[model samples]
Target: MLFSLVKKDLLLAKKYLMFMTIFSFVSPLLIASRSSFSDTGFVSLLITVLLTEYILYISISSLEDKSKGAALLCTTPYKRNGVIKAKYLLILIIFMCCFILYTILTYLGISPNIQQMSITKIGTIMLVLSIFFGILIPVQVKFGYEKTKYIGFIIVFLTPFVLPNLIKWYTSSNLSINFTISLSQNIYGWIPFVLSLIIGYISMQVSIRIYSKKDL
Candidate 1:
């Protein structure tokens, strides 16, 4: 039942998925051209942008039918929790597609060097994305689609501008300057990543709970 709901949703969203695929393939080339073939920042920025776009697009697409009352997925035999799980499943699949595309581009020399990749950086990126998605999904479920879209847009636009400066301020004033990254070759790199994952998981659970109780 859950699978059926997911399939229906995906069928409706196929056009967007196709767009994402084409974008993923072209992203590396675009980044390379923009950066004058500078590998690191361009690839990182491209990956970040691609992931953000896909996450938002999928979230919006998934809720479209529900918002319009054109379909009855929310009223199916599947538990609301199962419906949510299906979303995560679809998201993971889409995310994997992006990862694979990026990997191929890296290998083909259109992207950055794979060997220079920092697990910490990747983990941080995933954590940020998880938090963004986690916050947005439940809000969409509770408040309906249009309001959530505005809220999501505001957060996405503001966060990149806000976070770095906030971080710099905090670090500069702190005496210890203690910050951690996950997956550093040294023993401590995993701390921030693990912590972020935990937070992301908790945020997801909260979103699920909110969604489960909503009148949709």
Candidate 2:
């Protein structure tokens, strides 16, 4: 049943999925072209992975909200919990798809740097995704995607401006300096990787609670 719901969403968002695929293929070249930095490979990989997930997830949520499909889904055997579970499952699937595409691009030599994606990079990417989905899913479940998307836009626009300051603050602070240093070690990837999965699980629970109580 959960798989069916995932399949339904995928089918409904096929056009957006196609767009995501195209973006995944072209983003590396575009990002590499725009940046002369040595870390352009990492930058390209990060953007490609993050944006692909963003496009698919946002499109699915928007499609559901715009069509008033959530209310209808709740009326079916799927119900609210199933609907919420399907969303999380869909996100997991999307992440895997992105990783596979990344691997293929690397193998095909289309990616900027074949060796750029490592376990540490994967862990960092997953951590970022966990935080994003953790906040985004519950908020969207409560308010619907149409309303939450503006906030999404604001964050996307402000992140570059805010991130450097935040990093500087963190580096200057002694409180989390050790933790930050530890994360920089490649061997610690498993720690954040585990934490990412936990965050994703908790996020799903929160979204389920929000959607369950939602009037829609």
Candidate 3:
């Protein structure tokens, strides 16, 4: 049943997947060519992956809301928990597909200076997705996409542009505490992956409960 739901979503969002594939490949090329952000291949790769994932994520939600699909599904044999599981599963599948495509492109020298996509890089992307969807999915389950779209936009679209400056300011400010922890440290390096798994699990549980009890 969960597999059917995921397949349905994939079919519904096929156009979105195609659009994102093009966007993913083109954006990195543009970013790599730009003098401003072209400082590193990693930066361009990060932007491509994050933007693609966020777009696909919202596309599914928008489709569901517009079609009244979730409410309709509730009237069928599809359990609400299964529906929620399918959403998380679909997003995870999308994330993996994007990662693999980008990884292949990186190897093909699509992004300048990036020879390979590292494990740490993968972990970082997973962490960001886990947290991004963690908060948004439950809110979306509770309130529907209309009320949550703006928040998603701010987090996924606006935050990236402003985050660097915010980080710079926070680092430069004379705060009471200031220190740096290198991701090179073995313990620190694995933290992102660990947190991502934990957060993903908790987020799934929360979304399942919210959806199960929802008056759909």
Q: Which of the numbered candidates is closest to the native, going by highest lDDT? A: 3
| Each prediction's whole-model lDDT (CA) | 0.59, 0.75, 0.76
Q: In candidate 1, which residue pairs clash?
A: 181-189, 182-189, 182-190, 183-189, 183-190
Worst lDDT 10-window in candidate 1 = 34-43
Query: Comparing candidate 1 with candidate 2, which one achieves the higher TM-score?
Result: 2
TM for candidate 2 is 0.83
TM-score of each: 0.71, 0.83, 0.83
Candidate 1 residue runs with Cα over 4 Å from true position: 1-5, 35-71, 111-116, 154-189
The runs of at least 3 residues in candidate 2 whose Cα sits more than 4 Å from the true structure, single-residue gaps closed, are 111-116, 157-187
- Deviation in angstroms for 18 in model 3? 1.3
lDDT for model 3, on a 0 to 1 scale? Answer: 0.76
Residue 125, candidate 1: C-alpha displacement in angstroms:
1.3
C-alpha positional error of residue 161 in candidate 1 after TM-score superposition, expressed in Å: 8.7
lDDT by residue for model 1 (1-216), tens: 667766866776765767767777675456445442223443444354545465545455546645653235566566667767666556545555666676676677754433234566555555566666666666666776766666666665665445445555655687565456554475564654686668656766776797777765
